[model samples]
Target: MEKNNNEKLESMDTFKKLITALDAKLDSIDSRLKQQQGRKGIVKYYRNEDLKRAFGLSSNTIVKYRLTGVLPFTKLGDIFLYEASKIDKILRDNEC
Candidate 1:
């Protein structure tokens, strides 16, 4: 009876150790995912609708700005993407 109890206790200790190691691995993965998301936030991409809402401008005005080279942008097929960094620079340079 004493030997059986000792064996049970040893198995429980091994199970607890396994749980602790898995918990540490999960925490490390979560931290890496958050770091990657933070890096993406530093260089965000904006679409046409976002620009219209941000600047309170019409579609034609947005096109005019792009066509006149007032703001730099890139178009992939029908979707136009603007860099947040360049937009910030233009706004800062033209600040009143």
Candidate 2:
């Protein structure tokens, strides 16, 4: 009877340890899946052509705006990238 009691105790201890390890592994997997799913509700970037289309402005007008710092931009190898918030700010500032 004493040997049987010891066996039960050992089994219970091993089960608890196994559960703890499994919980840790599951938590890791959940975080990795979230990262792989891509970010949601993140800020989106716009390009020069996109800006022109959005504001109905010409290419020259866009270039002039960039040179004059009327719009905030990021230059990526000849491509002018703009942020949505910056564009909104410019429009708000220039509102008549």
Best-performing candidate as measured by lDDT: 1
- lDDT (tens digit, per residue) of candidate 1 on 1-96: 999999999999999999999999999999998999878456677798999999898999989999999869998899999998899999999999
* Tens-place lDDT digits, model 2, residues 2-77: 9999999999999999999999999999999898668766677888778778778899998898899887888789
Looking at model 1, which ten-residue stretch has the lowest summed lDDT? Answer: 37-46
Per-residue lDDT, model 2, residue 41, is 61
Worst 10 residues of 2 by lDDT: 36-45
- Cα displacement (Å) at residue 12, model 2: 42
Candidate 2 C-alpha error for residue 54, in Å: 1.2
Model 1 alpha-carbon miss at residue 54, Å: 1.7
Clashing pairs in 1: none
- Residue ranges of candidate 2 with Cα displaced over 4 Å: 1-41
